[model samples]
Target: MTVNDKLQADWEPKSDAVQRDQRAAYDEMRERCPVAYSDFLEWSVFRHEDIVRVLMDPDTFSNAASRHLSVPDGMDPPEHTEYRRMIVQYFQPERVDAFEPQCREIAAKRLQSLLGRDELEFIGDFAHWFAVRIQSASLGWPLEMCEPLRLWTQKNHQATFAQDRPAMAEIAKEFEGYVHELLQIRRAAGAQASDDITGSLLRQYVQGRPLRDEEIVSIVRNWTVGEVGTISAALGILVHYLAQHPDLQQQLRTQPSLLPAAIDEILRIYGPLVSNRRITTRPVEIGGRKIAAGERISLIWISANRDGRVFEDPEAYRLDRDPTANLLYGAGIHVCPGAPLARMEMRVAMEEILGHTTRIDPIPERPPTGAVYPGSGFATLPLRVR
Candidate 1:
């Protein structure tokens, strides 16, 4: 709350305009102030080039932006590399491949409950439900944990946006309790423990030492809450995007193989996750703004993915665009390790929806509600499923 910092504020991220339309606001901000400042998010980097620079050079823009432990995603250098290698096996091709049938089963069951309905609220009724169920099933969690995890994701987002450190800490501790209980269950089971991801984590070792409970909790938090939030938002965005774009929807329905590529492209155009935080290790200039060492900044993913400089006619949908340029799963050492599982979950969920229904159309009377900062996609998506 220094005078200089207050004076540097460029735009209000939670303004009415942004709340109404996040994409349009981000597009305008990226153009007007590529390196904007705000009280909420110290310095916001909106351009694709600047974000790519930040990602490629993690040494300069460190990912240890949180005060709490964040497993591999929020660590730096040597430490991140070690933890990353240990946990990546959970998302190996074989593991994710084995889970595909189960993922489809979860999606199908949710759809079956609403099969006869003409109109539905996709966000609450389907998107969040499916996201939580899939995450729970992946971890061998009981069906009862789904509702709690879904609610935890919501509360986590609220505390994050409000910058309520105490509330955030409380929820963090709550998540730790959940993980602790699960770990204890596995431990008690001994030789009969279910060999799921959660059980596997209890047996993981790092740097010649068994992984501590705190470390295990951090890892599960990154995988569960993070994936649940993003995957839910992503599914909502995909369904809403297809409903608005009939040509693409129909094309995908006919050429089902294109869904894998189509899902990434749609999410690129309308990102599910908003931004990631990084801190400066040394003074540097990005977008002509000089940032001092120890300063925190946000790389706006929603804006960066749609930067016209990188993707020609960035807003337009196209399959031919270069995949490497897209920062969907991010770039560099901190890139999302669970991308394989996430990709499979989304593809399977979308395939089930499209395969079972002939059309997904928007209800004229009930427009989708745009999620606020720190959360992307719709909060309430009312659509006609036929």
Candidate 2:
């Protein structure tokens, strides 16, 4: 069927029901209608098999769903290939290794601030701050930019959830302004520019030419948004999950070596990222649903990761599951380039958190508040730590 013919809504993405508990809602959608249609998301592919198919076939399921330029994330091959080459170098093993100390220091310091409190809101007191500080430190941004970046991330999430195109554009422009000023300072410094990620971006070349200022801004914006939002959510999810499962928490705390695999398993059970967008380049059929060319598609990462078809007893945490099958960082050519950095950051954060505290318990009187659409994990996670 063509786009015009399939006009009925299969789900309400913004309804309180779905927003209140997205994981459960998505799981329902995956089983009932794997390739479902909605006005807000256009077409949401909710199953692992279908999402994997789209990820593998980028030519047919193009990532150029956004009207705005999104550096490598919103670009398809040839263009995506070239820019990805330049981008990947920033997150190389050596670069990530060098940043490990700084990442841990930030995490340690943030955890110290929350230690005295008997009950704390983990998201505000620690998770968001760690995300902002580490991202700034990683990119050589001024510490003063932390608050603005945090507020900007919040506003960006609100704008995205509302699907406010104008607001999103204005927010993007605001981010561009911040990046442009940073670039200008570096340019003025000439040879004295700080030898950091942002400064080095000024020297990067793409297709035999230096990257444009706007392109640099786009790349930085993408990284900042990705790093801040997802890391914060992941931390909250990891902590909240551990608080509920004290046995698992104690096990991980006792054997810190199990954290890498444990963290991945927990996040797979509860995804940090909600979804990613794609556009159909040609007529395609997924899960017996027909979709036409030029239609927008949402690859529901949260749902795909929890699909029982691929993950047996999908909600149960299992460390032995095939790591490659877990779509935590995604798969195929456009998989997250910063996965290594993100993993390192999370592991360090957890290590410091678990090591510093003897126990982490959820405040039963003040239950955690789940973040709404476009955002995942707990928005207000109250935990008692000691």
Candidate 3:
């Protein structure tokens, strides 16, 4: 059945109540209505078990939720397999290790600038720039593209939240234009094109055929959005949490080696990503709710990771929890291929921040603003760093 045929709102996803505190709101939903239907988000699966069921049974719940070309992200099975293979190679262990030094340099430089300030809006001043810089550097994009890309990410979030299809289409076109120009330059340069990730993609092939310009744009768009939006939100959540829990902050500061695990745990507690989309290929019953074929389903990562059934003391910060249970990078075939890169980036950034400063405390008068639906973490994180 089509969206219009659906009746009875189970919950309002875009409501002020949910947007005010998404984690709490999702936690309530997990217990109240694990599988719910609404106009905004048709079927939101909030329980850990239900989401895991969806992730594992991709045949029943398809990832092809978008009409636009989304490369592997919007594909399934045989098609998804080939493109996923090509995407994973770019983020192999060796490649991620090679990029660490540059990532550290970017983090260190950004941290140095903010060290002198007594108080600053962390998201705008530091987090966003770090995400944008590292993403551009990794892709070998021109330095001039950084600001525009940052602005584009912001606009993309706004468009998504508003569910403004026309604005989203325009934003997508804007990104395509940037990527197409880069591809054109690389093609014109031929052998002289810098041997970077972007250049490497130009040489990549799929199904015994060269990738088209639109495909390349789609891939790059996915990477950029994933990197910029999620990383920025993750950083805000990490620093904000550290500022609140001084004990964990000091622990991580002394034992920098524990950063990788700590970052994962913290992100799991307050997921950087709000939700991932999936469409039911056929009718399926989950959490005692019967969802029709072709129904839109959203796996609420924020809710699933915090479910007390799977995670004991769901709100508490503990590094000893089972890593396998954490859905920070997700699970199953569609798990984030860039998990390694994201982990490295977050680890390095946290290390630099903790090493550089003695304290990261929240401002008493100005509390950090929680980011609304379609966004995670702080909208403006005001903190004192010294």
Candidate 4:
């Protein structure tokens, strides 16, 4: 397909689609524009191998300043390494284990509340709400703060797709102001930091000194804002898929032991976090295309995860698929720090949903994922439950 054809398809979802099926269009782009460049959006890398190479070789395709629109995860190593190390423990296995009961409780409570509703917007009601609350509580933030933070995060995300820098800047300022207040309160109260992730960060002494207020702000921004939306979006897509394939849902429900595997399969099939941007620090050739220094390259994770080069049946969802090779959480040094936690939340959420309900079906009339990145899903997913 032509570039305009691809752009048209990609941009189409912003208006017409559910935000979950952008993969077909992106897969087409990977074949057509493996190293495609846009004067407006820099380079776009679509091939699975090429994306892997970039993700693995952070020194060349540096993430130092390419994560999101800011400089936290965008900063490259060894600084990024330090920051990652300092907070990495927060999402470690044991830490995630500690939050399990809370995750299940939140999911169970939400499911209970929705018990008899004929229809519900799963994204707004359960997926987004539960993930936001779980993440907030995990970080020691008051559950009451979830709505405000959710609003700010949505505004910040919407601003990214905005064409004006001034508008994005204004949103950034607002986000910073709110985070700043939270940081101050947490510090002044000299509150005994709870044994959770946020508390761990607060008590952490990076480089042998207490983390600075600005540093704390950066960590929380990266944690809270960067996290919730993707998980919610992914959960919405997973739920929709499970609803459509009742047999698969049955398989999962019958063998709850299969959930972890099933979650990985679902993620591989419909990874919520779509693309990550990387800048070329040096000229390089990838997938037979020359990429010059300073150009932006989007590591199309959603496309890569679905590439036939890696997955045997790239488009099919198989619960039996081994997840070690999947790029859903990405690969290499800059891989997502919160992946373990996300997985934990998803497993618990799905378990609760499956345990409480027998079957789920997509409404007959629904939108498709056309061109948006990370595929927004389910404006509303109404399911019939027991």
Model 1 agreement with the true structure over 1-386: per-residue lDDT tens digits: 53345465799888888878889998999999999888888899999999999999999999999888889888997999999999889889999999999999989988988979999999999899998999899989989998889999999999987889999999999998998998999999999999998898888889999899999888889888678889999999999999999989999999989999999999999999999999999989999988888889999999999999999999889999999999999998888888999999999999999988999999998888889878999999999988
**lDDT score for candidate 2 against the true structure:** 0.93
> Compared with the true structure, what per-residue lDDT tens digits does model 4 show for residues 1-386?
43223332223323333244466667777776666655445567777788877888888888754434432477777777777887777788998998899889888988999978876667778877886898788877777788887787677666665545788777767767876776666667676535555555667775679877567767787777657877787788888888878898899898999887777877777777777778878888887766667767777787788888788888788755557678888888878888899888888988899898887776666533322433344445655555
- Compose the digit string of candidate 2's lDDT tens values, residues 1-386: 56756488999999999999999999999989898888888899999999999999999999999888889899999999999999999889999999999899888887787799898899999999999999999999999999999999999999999999999999999999999999999999999999988999999999999999989998999999899999999999999999999999999988999999999999999999999999999998989988899999999999999988889999898987999999989899999999999999999999999999999999988999999988999899999999
Error of 1 at 320 (Å): 0.9
Candidates sorted by lDDT, descending order?
2, 3, 1, 4
**Each prediction's TM-score versus the true structure:** 0.98, 0.98, 0.98, 0.89
* Strongest candidate by lDDT: 2
Pick the winner on lDDT between candidates 2 and 4: 2
Q: Which pairs clash inside model 3? A: none
| Residue 241's lDDT in candidate 2 | 93
Residue 126 lDDT in candidate 2: 94
Global lDDT scores for all candidate models: 0.91, 0.93, 0.92, 0.73
Window of ten residues with lowest summed lDDT in model 1:
1-10
Task: Estimate candidate 4's alpha-carbon lDDT, on a 0 to 1 scale.
Answer: 0.73
